[model samples]
Target: MDLIIRKYGGTSVGSIEKIKKIAQKTKDDINNNKKILIVVSAMGNSTDELLEKANQISKSPNQRELDLLMSSGEIISSTLLSMALQEIGVQSKSLTGFQAGIDTNTIYGQAEIQSINNDRIINEIKKGNTLVIAGFQGFNENLEITTLGRGGSDTTAVAIAASLKASVCEIYTDVKGIYTADPRIVKNAKKLDFLAYEDMLELANFGAKMHPRSIELGMYYKIPLIIKSSNDQEDGTLVCNSKDIKNLINKGIIMNNITENRNRVSGVTSEGNISKITLKNIPDKPGIAAKVFEPLSVSGINVDVIVQNISNKNKTDLTFTIDDKDFDKTIKTLEKESLKIKYESIMSGKDYGKISIIGSGIQNAPGYAAKFFDTLSKINVNIEMITTSDIRITCLIKNDDLDKALIKVHEVFELDK
Candidate 1:
């Protein structure tokens, strides 16, 4: 039987009614003779509520215990969904990540999946039982429970699909599909029918609908991933490598024969809660860069969009962006290492967010950049820090102007058509 891997996000399985709806969908899949294995996230806000309860007990809970406590949310979801499936006359079984043979590294909060043994999963499927595995978690080498950080459920789903060699991975979320811009913000934002893996990777990296690691897993495994809506049976979006793209690209893009917007760019994505930290007046030297960033790296804080000013008088300034969640931790870590790094002072701000446009052949074609900047210029939004890959251009702007800038850019790039 051809196997299919489907993952439902927390919002998709938020209520008993929603779970029943999903069960019905599963029944339809089975009726069509496709072997479907599901991965499920915790019910909506359950993980956050659990974290809040833990915070009520202690400001800094033990990492190991925190992972153990947080993992229960997904277990609850998996079990509940399995019960729903059974009640609806679908034979199904729920398994924790470990029970499904997912093993990870020792990191408690953000463990990396090391391997997955397909023996139990295969056996359960062979017995005609659909497997519903808890997402976002696994066990470490020491057999301790570990969570996969923020986007862990997506990671779990994709990793499992890759490990089991499933035909394709479907990510069912609240949104209809990947859009030209967030449909909530840009009213005219159009849904993209297909995306190259590289383009999607850029989007994921710059705060699109996906987690970078999950997209990376999909790209590396060569698994075709579809992002679809759980609330309706809409053709959401297909993300795959270029070779598998349907039809041929005419005029730098193709969108299932949609001719209104034919451009190299795919989408506009935005993110808030950005914090930029600058180490001012650092002694311009060979190893200063390492000294500045090494501490943040060791602390597992993600730093993005780095900039180094020109050296003058044997001193220079270094700036980088990170998610504001790590602001306090980043400050403390840098302050602790300030003397060693020998920076004059630290300047930080929480007033910034990023807006980005991602697509294909951006560097090779200069018009995209000119148009992007011109669009922002017209809105009078000042760009702070700028970062780019061949397929993406990201600009940090004042949070106040983020919405207008994103919408204007969407219109300017013709992504709304």
Candidate 2:
């Protein structure tokens, strides 16, 4: 029998009735002679509510206690789902990530999975029982409960699929699947039947809710996934292990999620609430840049969009993107480098938005950039910044004009049609 791994998001198992529907689905799979493993997120918004409650009690809650508290949401859902399955006369067992042996690092909020043992899961499957797993949370080396941060359930499902070598991992969400653009933004946006890992990664990074880290796990394990709406039978998009799909001409219409009035060179995406650290003068020496960023690297603060301007009179300006979440840590790390480099100033603003338009055709079309800018110029939109890659173009625009910018740029490329 083929092994099947299915994951239901919070909305999918939000209530007892919904849990019953899930249990029935699992029973259907079992009756069809498939070995089943189901991973489920907490009931709708339960985790968020829990966090809100925690924040109510404490301005800064202890990470370990918060992890333990947050994990209970999923644990409750898993057990409820299991009970629901039993009520339907289907044999099933509920498992937490720890019980399932998903060993992870000690990071309390955003722990990374080190490995997953499948012995217990495999045995349950052999016994003709469907296994229900609490997703998103795992246990650390200290055996303390820890969570894998936002979209962690998606990551959990993929990680479990990898461990068990399941045929395919199914992601049941509110939407049918990946669309040409977010359906909310583009009503006529078509649903994509398939996508490559890289495109999905880009889409996820650009506000697609499917989550980039889960896609990363799927790619690493070469696992195929179906992103479908939990409420329907519509055949959702299948993300597969095929480079062939990425090669198809105009395989998908990727939307640039930015708004501006005037057309510029290309699309732009910028994260405001981002900081820029300029290490000036650094003796105009080699290894200086490396020395400045090495501490940041160790602290795991991801630096994005690095730019080094030409040194005027043997002085340079360095700018990189680190969001508000890491802003405090980034400043702390830079303090250590203060002795080595005398910089002008550390600056940040929460006044910008990152906008990007992604497609594979840009590299071959020499005039695409000019056309993009001309369109913006015609509309009187002023661009703040711009960046490009072989297949994509991005820009920074005023957050207020983001919607107008996206629609106009989308229209310029005839992306909507």
Candidate 3:
């Protein structure tokens, strides 16, 4: 018997009708002799609604209590979906994250998954019953409820699939699959039938809908992941290792047999809600960089796109970008540590966004970076900061110009065609 894991996002199980549709799909799978394990997120905007309710009661709610309150949404979803399945004559069982044996670190929110004891899951599957597990929330070493951050459910699904060594992990979302660009922003964006795990990871990290941690887990476990729409059966994008992709290309299975250009640009992505902070004229000493970032790390704030220039007069400026939501906390943290770090001044900028282009072998392709900047220049868009890796090149620009920049870059790569 082949075992598989499938995860549906909030919008997928947002209503009773959608849940019934999912039940029918699962029943069909069961009849096909597939042992299925399902993971579901909170229905619709229930998570957001719950958070709003918490905020209405207290300005700064306790993190531990907040996690406990937020986790209820997924419980509601998993149980309701299980009821729907039973109503349709399908034998099913609903399990919370803890009940399914998901154990994590002690962090209340944004907890890292430490391990999964699959004994309970294995026992449930052995009974010939479909197991529906709640996503996003898990238990810590102290056995307290903890919630994974945004897109945490995806991580949960991938982690479980890896633990159980399932055949495949399927992620059902609102979109058909990964695209050359966000279709909403670039109307002509084309869907990619296949993507390398590394490319997918870069895209997710740069602001695609898929979670970066989930992609990382898939890559580590060599698990094949499929991303498609929940509303319909469509050939969605397959994400796996580059070796697998190359094998398919050699067999004339992908991209119309144009393997020669396999190393070309894959996609362009943009992320808004960015804020940049620069610590000006800090002493260019060995421990200065550590001093600046360690506090932010301990405070649970993620820093991105760091750049430090050459030392001038034994002093240099350190700049980095972070999610706008963390801007205020970051400022406050730095303000409290100013006397110790001893920087000349602290400056901040908001309304900035990042645009990136990713592919497998883009670094070896000559003129790609030059061409990227040239395209932006043609549109009168100004680039603020630049970063690059072997597979990606990123530029910072004004948030107002992000849409125009995306369209121009997507066209330059001819991704729409």
Candidate 4:
């Protein structure tokens, strides 16, 4: 039998009522004679709640213990889902990450999945059982449990799908597929029916709802993923290769986008809670940046949008941005190596946000950058820093102006149309 991988996010199975509905949906799929492997995240905000509890106990809870505590949230949802399935007269069983044979590296909080031994999963499928496997948490080399951090469940679902070589992976979330701009912020943001993996990856990296890592896995594995709302009947968006079968269903959605002008720019995205840090008066020598950032690299802090001022008197200023959560960690890391880095001063601020335009080769094409800059200028939004890739153009600006900036740029490009 052909196998399908269906992943329900935390909100999708948050309550008893929703879990029962999911149980019914599973029954419907089984009635159609299709086998499914269900992957699930923790219910509602249980993971956050658990983390809050850990914080109450100790400000710095041990990483291994924290992983242990957080894994319980997913375990609760998976077991409840399996019980609901069984109560509805369906043959189903719940499995934790270890039970599901997901092996990862030694990292406790953000472990990378090394491999997945799906022998047990295959056996369960052979016995006509629908397995409700917990997402996010997995085992390390020594059998210690680990959790994949931030968007971990989505990563887990895609990784499992790739390992099984399943037909497709369906990710059910609260949103009705991907949008041209954030619907909550921009009321008229359009729902995309399909997207090229590259376009989706850029959008997600900038500010789209789905995680970039999940999109990356799908792109690398050539796995077709459907992202849709679990709460309603809205159509889902499929992310896959542009040359995939979607061209047959919606031939012009991506192919003739530029010529038709319906979607001149594929989407606009904005991300807040960013902190920009600048190291002033450093020697303008090669490898100076490497020396300064190596500690942060070792600490796994993601740095973006590096800008170096021209050398004056053989000294230059270096600036970069990172997520707000890592602001203190990065500051301390730099300070600890202050003598080695030999910088004059540290300047940092938390009032920054990034606004980006994403599409198929929009960055490479002329005039898109001009249109973006012009639109922001009319709104009095000053661009602090700018970065570009083959398909994305990003601008760092004041956090307060992100909403207005996104709307104006979306309108300028006619993405809502």
* Residue 236 error, candidate 4, Å: 0.9
TM per candidate:
0.95, 0.85, 0.96, 0.95
lDDT of 2 by residue, 1-64 (tens): 5576889999999999999998898788678676778999999999999999999999889999
Q: Least lDDT summed over 10 consecutive residues: which range in candidate 4?
A: 252-261
As a whole number from 0 to 100, the lDDT of residue 233 in candidate 2 is 82
lDDT of 1 by residue, 1-417 (tens): 556799999999999899989998899978977689999999999999999999999999999999999999999989998998999899999999989989999988989999998799989998989889999999998999999998899999999889888777889999988888889999998888778788888888877888989999999998878898999877678888656654333311223542322467888899998999999999998988999889999899998899999999999999999998999999999999988999999999996899998878677787887788889988798989888888888899988899999888988878765
lDDT score, candidate 3, position 273 = 86
Candidate 1 residue-wise lDDT at 232: 85
**Candidate 4 lDDT (Cα, 0 to 1):** 0.88
The best candidate in terms of TM-score: 3
Task: Kindly give the number of clashing pairs for every candidate.
Answer: 0, 22, 0, 0
Question: Per-residue error at 327 for model 4, in Å?
Answer: 1.6
> Per-residue lDDT of 271-364 in model 4, one digit per residue for the tens?
9999999999998998899998999988889897888998999999999999999999999999999998899999999979999998886745
Instruction: Note the residue pairs that clash in candidate 3.
Output: none
Better of 1 and 3 by TM-score: 3
Per-candidate Cα lDDT values, in order, are 0.88, 0.75, 0.90, 0.88
Cα distance off (Å), candidate 4, residue 138: 0.6
